[model samples]
Target: MPSRKPSASLLDSSQDDPSPEDALALAEQAEAEAEEAEAVAAAARARARAIRLRNQAAARELLAGNDTEAETSSAESTVTEQAEPTETAGAEDADEAEEKEEEATARRRRLHIPRLFWKVLASCLAIIAICALLGASGFMIWKHGQADHRRQLTAEFTAAARQSVVTLMSLDFNHVQDDVKNILDNSTGDFKKDFEAQQNDFIKLAQQSKVVTESTVNAAAVDTMSDDNAVVLIAATTRVTNTAGAQQQPRSWRVAVSLTREGGQIKLAKVEFVP
Candidate 1:
């Protein structure tokens, strides 16, 4: 029997089927392409990562440089600020020193004095000193003269007091008018007026009573004395001859006398007996 003719469909199917070797070759080619594609993709990723890292490094370096520049600028500004006051203070000190030097120079320049004016001023001062000394000497002399005058006045007052006391206390009845007149001459003020008014009566009483009196001053002292007034304490003893008998008595008296000087003579202004 002859082999049956293969079917057309079977023939076509057999022609369409690949051999195993060819299939293996095709699979190997596909694997090679896939590996190449994967390698290319990995290279692209690596390049991107390296570029990113480089960019980041550059950015960090830029920031660091900026920070360093900023710090350096800040330091420079601080140094400038610190130096400014020192420079200003030095300038001010220099100006002050120059001003003080100028003032000293001006003072030295202004120190000139004229010799003539200085001599004149000194002469005037010496004249004034001499005048003052002369005036003081004159005043001292005047004081001494016044003291001598006061002593003279005191002596005169003491003599007058003794004389007046002796004249007043001693009285004689036979010469009553003369005795009263003598008392009137030595006495002044109220004592003079009162004695003058009672003169006639005193004379009559003395003539009738036949009274005779003699007084002697024992001691007298001036208590207070001034230029115009004096107080004197006088102690005396009196002998009285009356119709009954003759008696001697001791008496104490105080007298205030006021004097006025007129035409270089001291006259009594007031006289009083103090109890």
Candidate 2:
């Protein structure tokens, strides 16, 4: 009794089938692979959700920035429009005030200038008239003073000339020394020198001739006058009584006498007979 031989299909199936331990290991490995695949899918989904949230947040921030910029621009434009009209109105008001002030100043100047000018003119005229009056009064005083001074000079010169002529011509033989001394005292310069040189001869002649003379100055006038010197023209008469005359004889004479100031006294400098 031989057992029946196994079919080929069955034998192959049995050889291909794993053992229980191998099947269990294979099933465990498959389960582990499935679990690992599920974990990888979950990681991928989490990364995609995070990326979408970040993209949405970025879009919201961009929209907010753009809205803020638009609002700022609109506000700036409104402020510029309002400020421009206000500044223009203020400038027009300033110009109107300045023009009104200038017109008022011009009207005040026109109203007051003529009165001020006439007052200044009258003051100047009064000053000028006062100066003219003072000047005329001073001139008149100076003129009168000068006339008085000239008259005093003429009188002094005339008196000196008359006295000099009288002293020169009057002589007496009885008082010959006194007569010569008087002549010398009243004279100076060339007359004194020349008369002194011929004094002895004149004295001798006067004594020998027994002369007595008397003189009178009829008139004396100053011809040319200065501060310290003067020339005078004199009309004089001399009465002579000598040995050859029975009575006194009168002689008319014209003399030009030059006078000088000597030691505060006027003296005769020179004398010339006028023919």
Candidate 3:
């Protein structure tokens, strides 16, 4: 038998089949191309991101500049508005203070006193001082006059007491009745009643004894005095004589006599002997 002739399809298939080494080379080349394409795409994306970041930075800078300008304008306008009002208020306060000072000065000038008015005030003060001095002098003179009058009254009382005490001690038996009568006349009140009641006995005793007494008042003083009454103290010495003639030693006597104004005369109301 003769070998069959190969068909066109088989011939073509066998020719198209690659060798192992060629297939390996083709796979390596394809992988290299794919890696290069991927690298190109990554580079494109990186460029786009860089462009976006730059634009954002520029936009923020522009916005910040605009805000700063607006704020500066507004602050300048506010400062200008406030400055005008503050300056005007300061000027007005200064004017008002100056006007008040001027008014106070004018008021002081209006209330000023005149020289003549001061002179008249001084004259009135001098006159008042003179009047006060004269009044003081007059009061002193009146006080002295009152003292003199009291002294005169004391002397008068003392004289009356001395005279009355002397009268009482001087008694003679022969003139007993007359002496008793004189005693009764000089006295009033309890003294007069007591002596009158005992007068009869006193007269009888003197006549029987032939008694005679002469009295001398040594000293007299007004102890107490009022408008209508006075008390007087008297120191007296008496000489007594009987049938024996006269006593060698005179008897000393102290008496207190109370006198009252009766019928415009100072008369003894009571008498007491003092030890």
Candidate 4:
């Protein structure tokens, strides 16, 4: 085939498809896309490189430290971000855990009662026991007081009887003085020696003065008495006749007497004469 020049019409048609400005703009666009792709590839490579560097730094820190520090670094420590908050997160976590535990502990502690309750219970019981004991003691004291009053009444009655008996002895039984003396020598005697002696003395005195009569006994009631371990005291009053020589007049004389117990029976101790 012979070399020939291309037709200008085909050249013109092809030229019409793309102007110079359009071609230049397309070239510029392609170059900008290429530059953007190169920038993205570089960014990805840098990110990968940074990740590798961080991992290496962590491993190095772990290796360089002791067992405790290595564990700390291996767990969460990083060369870049290590200084930022190593203890803050752990301490915060610990604080939160401690706070929760303390709250739980407080709740548990509230359910337990103190020893003071038992002590209070014991004290109350002791107080009640003491009150009961005191009440019993008071009752006993009241009972004893009543018994003492009864004993005092008995003593008064016995004193009256003893005095009455002594007064009786001084009456018309002037002839009975020797009989009383003999009775004193016998254990089976109705009266004790001091009692008989006292009676006998009064009888002898009454007969000597001749103021006695048989009606002396009939004019009165006599005798009620008691004794203590050591002694007895008594009181009495009496009426006796004073006679004139012709039996024409009989005047009455009043007498009072006190007696005391000696050797287990009442003895004449004193007398008061009343006219």
Taken over the whole model, the C-alpha lDDT of each candidate is 0.68, 0.80, 0.76, 0.52
lDDT at residue 269 of model 1 (Cα atoms): 51
Compare candidates 1 and 3 on lDDT and give the better one: 3
Q: Write the per-residue lDDT of candidate 3 for residues 109-222, one digit (tens) a residue.
A: 766655567888999999999999999999999999988877877877777788788878899999999999989998999889999999999999989989889899998888
**Cα distance off (Å), candidate 1, residue 180:** 0.5
What lDDT tens digits, residue by residue, belong to model 2 across residues 106-165? 999997999899999999999999999999999999999999999988888899999999
Q: List clashing residue pairs in candidate 4.
A: 158-225, 158-226, 161-224
Q: For model 3, what is the alpha-carbon lDDT of residue 10?
A: 35
Q: 6 in model 4: Cα distance from truth in Å?
A: 40
lDDT of 1 at 244: 71
Q: Candidate 2 regions off by >4 Å? A: 1-108, 243-245
Q: Which regions of candidate 3 are displaced past 4 Å?
A: 1-117, 246-248
Please give the lDDT score at residue 46 for candidate 4. Answer: 82
Worst-scoring 10-residue span by lDDT in model 2: 1-10
By summed lDDT, the worst window of 10 consecutive residues in model 1 runs over 1-10
